[model samples]
Target chain A: SYYEKVGFRGVEEKKSLEILLKENPLDLEKLSTFSQRFPLPSMYRIHVWKVLLGILPPHSDSHALVGGYRKEQYNDILEALHVMRYVNCSTPFTDVCLRMFQLESQVLPRCSETTGPDEENEDFLSIARSMEEIVDDPIDCYWLIKCFVHQFHAKFGDSIPHLPKSLEHYLSQEEPRLLRHLKNTDALAQLPYGLWFRRCFAGCLPESSLCRVWDKVISGSCKVLVFVALEILLSYNNVLLGISRPEGVAKLLCNIPQENTDAIVTKAIDSWHKYCGTPMHAV
Target chain B: FLEDVKCQAKAELQSSDGRYQAQRRITQLLQTELLQLYSRVETEAPAGTASGSPPGGRADSYP
Candidate 1:
């Protein structure tokens, strides 16, 4: 009901989404093309992402399970954020959140001008606080979806290119010059996208831009995570090529490149299409 | 400026001693994560090769 009212509502989009959702084996190709171009209607993101990530089992009852999983886990992250801000840090979740903050502020791509030294907002806490019943803020959904993505990454890390290899492979094909420049940065010297990937590109991407990319990711393949990330990083090719140090490279990539999220998503789609065209490239 | 001060003031005023223990804890937390990431990925792909393999090893084809 909420999703019908708040998400997946537009007539054409609703029809398309309905037809696509009914696929038995899931038409990932069709799903991929559709989602890469459009954001899932706001209320519809979590479940679609679950299906795309294979977080939800391929069964008829997945729709019912989505609500239970989202509510329970969203509260857990909120509690974890509260513990970090108020109580003494004891568990692994606080550690994870802290790492998330560091990755965003330091190693992820961010804008230099707007990223002043302002850590005042219990930004995570406020994010948790602001979440509505069905969740408007997908940041929490990131933690949840990312849990699924991490499982996919880890389970497949040994098989598919792990995050670092994904980055190395993608860069080799797309941004050779920038790859050469970052050869020495401590972070990248060993694995440029390792920490970035472990953190699920949280700090590295803006919420809006990341959500758009996640839309494609949830529908098609988790491998899209690395490709879109590569897409984003390669979009910064000129900037990255100029910076030889890993720290500088990390900072450049960590900052959200610009405010126009749609532009970034559009560019990433082009990169995704091109990368996917060379079937064996980085997937 | 005010945001920084408020953030700072909140942490600083957390106790009479004026030390925000959370900063130290957070820094330590981040350090742990970096170490874990390095050990997990680097020992495997030191050369930064395009396959997720340990040194001198070949990647296994997916089943």
Candidate 2:
């Protein structure tokens, strides 16, 4: 009950967002403050994310081009998953961001091609180049895709040998009591991050909070995911550490209270900013 | 988009073209909890590794 964090109300948030949007290139510095608020307005969330992710075109594509890219997105995922399946496995959960992030990175030109943003912007240029390097290497491209899929199954697969590797990534820094609970077999099944990246919170958080997380991620980099996950755990740290069994710990993480969306997100944004001062440059 | 997925799922159910048979078959096989797909191909391959190795070889072997 004490965990909630205050966020901006309607008029204040709308005014902030409108100012950020008015600039021809989209005012990114203003965006940082706007995003930190958490639980952003619901209706404009998708449009806001498209801007941050560089999916929307500055000049609208012909309806056909928009339609074509959506089709291409689907085909690319099925194609990539086709590659994964041949390897004889499948991700435990569907990755909603995979095609949009992966396929877009591989096939679509970065903001330079997609949004036609300022060619001189260092962030856009860096994002574009990193994407190109991954796409250009066919071997590395598939390897990345395979890891995305295996991240879910490989960590949570029923086999004893395939214990949760992702848990070790961050849990090593957690309180020992929490770390012990996380290592339990059942708790690992409902791992907070799982394998899907943004999809991990798919049906979990408030729509507004969820979109804000995406905004931070697309505008910055993949480094935001781990920081955000850690923030969530910190909120329930003492309560979670007290729990004895795996199922109990999992139940707490799986059903995080909606009211704390504001707090969880605020902390996550701050930590993401602090830990990832320079974006890691990978998707 | 959901509608498109529903239609495709229906088509796959109604004996649609096997154009994506490999994709479909692999999804089906995964339900059996086979740890690795290509390994089965190797074991069952009448022609041995040369013929049995998957189109991409072992999925885990990817760099």
Candidate 3:
């Protein structure tokens, strides 16, 4: 909790965001680049995320209009769910209807007793549970994650093709010997990249660090994510080199130091620039 | 006014598309890099650098 408070930017950072918010036509490119470089204060994150996620339009003037519509839509969806609660779950068509509603609204569908939890449902639940820890309102959390998933699903969807391989590639670039060690010992396959990439390191990294990492993801490319994962592995380079078992390597990666939020992000950014040949925001 | 909103939405979509394209391009590059490294590793004999030595059990003090 203290870490979260400390994670908030200084007065100058807050003032900078406020100034950008006041601009008549928000410069999203500048806003994105700024957000990528600095940790967004808790107060400004929602607005910045909303605009970037396109939940609120880019233009400041249209916020109220679009906000009103989105609120009405959410309320309507809520009302429908309330009515749906009274319906019989045994009806075959009800399941189909619920699925369609989830597809349309992007809201986490109320879990039914009859149906098994699918991967999509589990993913949404994981994200909702994670956001609930950080954000207060269930509604706001729902919309934020919904918009986020919609925006970056291709890059981070359930099956992110070549994610672990790409991580290995970056690792090799940094520490070829470390990568070799991991491969020789068959520890590379033990890495929880599904949790790392698909969940955006939600459970792997500390929540404060996770939020900052997500901020970069929202503002920049998913390429930054690979570097972040690489940074985590490299932090344990020496330790991993000594360990021989795959389970030991995976366990070490699962829990990492929380205080290095700034260092990890800074190093990740440097690594991104080194490999990508451009700053994350530039892409 | 409605057209302006539509245009804004289009621009946002285009920006998002650009990010996705960039992500894909980077993925392809990384794949190529991995392939090159694979070939290099194959050509060079195993260095036997990684040892199965006992760990010191230190987690926090990273180098």
Candidate 4:
């Protein structure tokens, strides 16, 4: 009975997605709008992500060929990197890349043929812990992370494109008092936004809410991240205001328990609608 | 080919049958809660001023 009542909505959403997927030259605009509005059915999420992220082309006919080509390219890159890692330990790659490469080797059965015993990547568990449940297949996860890095410029470092400055801009407009308090206490400067922006809130939010926020990001622009970040700070404004120490503020903001998903994301989406066309092009 | 992929995925979704019943239940429950929250927020908020937070004192009104 509960399933009959609640499952209908998800089923309807799935049907709509199916219709969109069946379109010949798939109407990307409509699909984006669809993804922006409704929850993506779990069954079709990877394919929809592939299409939206341009890993698979828009033309339905090209799906198989392009998917094959991209997977091969991914494997070839891994094999090359595997060789290089052995030859030169100084080769530069992000921790995410090294972790994903090691994870891929473990997951793909054939990888044992080429991939040598990499020093265990214990660091990825801390970084991408949430990804374990959301995406089962490491190959899909690898490509998704690669495309995310390309699309979102998700490099973890001091220089996130539009960071505390854009965050300050939104804060001034939405929560001026909170902004003033953060500045007065020097709390804003200490927030770990680089990690948040770099990973696109992968570990911060639960899988469902993260997926919803990411749907908006994929549909619209990376600017959506700013709105999500702002909404999050605003959500915890009261807690933040009472704290004067930078460490306390940073600690509290970093670990928002995975509750209130709808309210946060809904407000973020509202913010996106209101301010999307403005000059927030720091991406 | 995309159609075929979709068909295969749909079939997989069906084939799981009762195996994924527990996961599906959790997802449905979460989805229902989310829909309820969406409608409540939608009804309370005004027509425009989307950038402004909801009129409530708390930002998210999580309670």
Candidate 5:
């Protein structure tokens, strides 16, 4: 029933439609390159590209565009798309974002045809609409990231002997930076749901660790900010996963056992209340 | 706050040979126990389907 609501009933058809929507009439070279690099059953590259385009400056070059697409953002969009396809039991928005990304990445560089006023307006309006929808919910992005990280740790933990040294260094540095962003009340509160999760959860950490980190962050003095942030994250999770806030959080915290739930919930509430006591709340 | 906890936990986990082994066990135990309690609330929470549809009912869903 829930899956039906998110347009999961005909995933193959939907996916095919996404493929068609992503079909570009120009720049076959870039399109072919994208296809060759990401040989998956789904349009993961397209989704990542959509997020990149959405955030990238309109005038940025290909090198700048790729450079601006942070590893965290790429992983976040990838994970979000994965969850949308498999776990969340929905794929339409993911498909749309993927299409947007694909269009931006593939079409933007080579097209000589100027975007007509109506088309430009439509694109802006679509982006704004998507942003509004994503910002309205929070948990989806968190769950997407949580699931992504969990699966990654499971697949790669202590087994992948040939991991690139660059990746290792990147992980060591980037993971903390992303986590710190999530912990920042002012910063996290400002991000759209998709970007927030991409920036925070799509990295090389144990899902258990991520949840623990999130819990600790939530428990600190900025609880209201964290709670509101978590609320947004959970809302996004619910959308993607076909679960509710508590359900999504429950799943995210699945690695945590029952006895600690009370402690964690109490800590979260206390932190939120404490945060509410601030001058920021008075305004 | 997480960094602080992580630092403390990492330190605690690394303090003793036995504790290091136990850290993995404890974190797992804590996660499982806490999640069971939290799951009950998840079922009742509202679903966050995006508003509006673009023809064939493609609404963005997350989890």
Candidate 6:
């Protein structure tokens, strides 16, 4: 009886009712009427309707069953479906919402003025927050660092080709505190090589004359720090990839005590040489 | 053979234009897709300490 009122033909069975809906979609008036009567539809029924709407041939169907909804309404429906445990069914709708959001954002006015010192500080804080969120997952950190490097490239242009140096200058100027924080947290020890490269080097350097400046800055102290950071990063990678124990690295590090920073620099250079000479295929 | 050469030249010109368009489209798609993917993950991921648990836990450890 209610089915008929909603433009669904069958009177007896729900399956017959579903068949009628499939064959003949309800008009807007009938849909509103049904919504008024039923109030909230079952998740399963909503998912079924979504699938039908997605796959139905364009321009052939008589009734525009779900045609007039806005992007936000569609997003709300998908979110509702997700909350109701219909995640698998909600992906297409989610994708549509994502696309719509992208389109809308692209059309919005761009902020063109150069960010002042305070704004830059705020940006650094935001970046720090993002870094903190991703610290535990090396894979995620790798991509996040890539994004940061890209942002630096966009801001400073291609004055520096070396990604690591560009990042070092950017970080040193924008958020020296982040570098200090990272060192204090021993985050370099836990990061993978790509992420470590991104964070420690790329986040720190400037875009101007990086190659010449980089060599100049690689003094004994900086060299020692870089070596320790690289070792930690490489060891983390080895652990993650099930590579053999970095015994060679350990032996090299053992030769240099923690206090002899100059010796650490020499040992680090030697260690890098030895590691680089190892068969590339082995890595 | 001359006609074939003309056709080939025409096709090459079309292909060159098509390739440029395709490359531009791919670049746009990649930029948009990567941004969307990053934002989606950022929104869905737990903030602060909640994300501190390693992804998929210790079972996901490399060794």
Question: Judged by TM-score, which candidate is best?
Answer: 3
Among all windows of 10 consecutive residues in model 2 chain A, the one with the lowest summed lDDT is A91-100
lDDT string, candidate 4, A1-283, tens digits: 8878669877877887898889876777777778776667778877887777766666677667566655665555544445433224454334435533443333422322565554223323323455555777766776665565455543323345666688889899999999999999998888877546666676677788887777766665566778889999889988988999999998887788778966887788788778864323211
Please compute DockQ, using alpha carbons, for every candidate against the native two-chain complex. Answer: 0.01, 0.03, 0.04, 0.01, 0.03, 0.01
Name the lDDT value of residue A242 in candidate 5.
Answer: 40
**What's the true lDDT of residue B48 in model 2?**
40
Candidate 6's TM-score on the B chain: 0.45
Q: Relative to the unseen true structure, what is the C-alpha lDDT of residue A276 in candidate 4, on a scale of 0 to 100?
A: 64
Superposed model 1: Cα runs more than 4 Å off: A1-14, A21-39, A50-134, A137-150, A153-155, A159-161, A184-192, A258-261, A278-283, B1-63
DockQ of candidate 1 relative to the true structure: 0.01
True contacts kept of 1: 0.00
Instruction: Go through the candidates in order and give each one's C-alpha lDDT.
Output: 0.52, 0.48, 0.67, 0.65, 0.35, 0.35
Superposed model 5: Cα runs more than 4 Å off: A4-13, A16-22, A26-198, A203-228, A232-283, B1-63
The model with the greatest DockQ is 3
Q: What is the lDDT of residue A142 in candidate 3?
A: 56
The per-residue C-alpha lDDT of model 3 at residue B25 equals: 39
Better of 1 and 2 by TM-score: 1
**What is candidate 3's TM-score for chain B alone?**
0.65
> Which segments of model 4 are wrong by more than 4 Å?
A1-13, A79-132, A154-160, A277-283, B1-63
Segments in model 3 whose C-alpha atoms lie over 4 Å from true places: A1-14, A86-113, A155-159, A257-262, A277-283, B1-63
Q: Provide C-alpha RMSD values for all models, in order.
A: 20.3, 16.9, 21.1, 23.9, 27.7, 28.9
In model 2, which residue pairs have backbone atoms overlapping below 3 Å? A88-B37
TM-score of predicted structure 6: 0.19
Best by lDDT: 3
Model 4: how far is A27 from its true place, Å?
2.5
Task: Report how far off residue B60 is in candidate 5 (Å).
Answer: 45
Model 2 DockQ, alpha carbons vs. true complex:
0.03
Please, what are the lDDT tens digits per residue for candidate 1 over residues A1-283?
Answer: 9767645456677678777778654555655566665567666676566555544434434434444454444444344345434223563443344334444234322222244443322333223222222344444444543444455445555544455676678888876766766665454554335434444444555666666665654454556667766776666777666766666766666665567556766676667667665233111
